[model samples]
Target: MAKVKLTAVCKVCGSEIELPEDVMDGEITSCPTCGTRYIVRLKGEKVELEEFKGDVEDYGE
Candidate 1:
């Protein structure tokens, strides 16, 4: 049997982002085109992507 691939559209660059078939919810995935990070959300048999926000680190200011 052949392995199936999952895909999602990038919200920033409108490109296709390939995902693993066993990808889990809350996993981080980035776009190759725009380098935008997204959080994977699995709802039943559907997959949803949400933009990820990173916390800024302070360098001893």
Candidate 2:
């Protein structure tokens, strides 16, 4: 299997989180800094760029 680069932003505290490739779909994880909760989803088989929109976009590029 290949490694996937996953990232998500904290809606509560505005923190950016970079998830590991193993962090699969339907998994609920919390932000390391602020403890904000989020769900890991797989919109496609490969990584999705459009997923990191809004607050999460800054840290990505």
Candidate 3:
């Protein structure tokens, strides 16, 4: 499988944050410095935060 390279930013601070070691569908991870959660959003869906995991296949499998 191809690795995804996603980038996230801190809303509180103007700091540029990148995706952690691994990001899941609902695993919430925080920033090491700003302590901000990396939330993910989808179009025409519900508003919620995402999860973090070392791999993507760990979701309900």
Candidate 2 lDDT, tens digit per residue, 5-33? Answer: 67776766767778887866755567789
Q: Which residue pairs collide, candidate 2?
A: none
Clashes of each: 0, 0, 3
Local accuracy of candidate 3 as per-residue lDDT tens digits, 1-61? 8765555656666565566435454555566667766545533323334444344455436
Query: What are the lDDT scores of the predictions, listed in order?
Result: 0.86, 0.61, 0.53
Highest-scoring model, lDDT: 1
| Native-to-model Cα distance after best TM-score fit, residue 40 in candidate 2, in Å | 1.0
Residue 33 lDDT (model 2): 92
Arrange candidates by TM-score, descending: 1, 2, 3
Q: Candidate 3 at residue 45, lDDT? A: 29
lDDT of 1 by residue, 1-61 (tens): 9987789999998999999999999888899999998889989878899998883232112
Give the deviation of candidate 1 from the true structure as CA RMSD. Answer: 5.0
Superposed model 3: Cα runs more than 4 Å off: 1-4, 20-22, 41-61
Using TM-score as the yardstick, the better of models 2 and 3 is 2
Give the TM-score of each candidate: 0.81, 0.58, 0.44
At residue 3, give the lDDT of candidate 1.
87
Off by over 4 Å in 1: 55-61
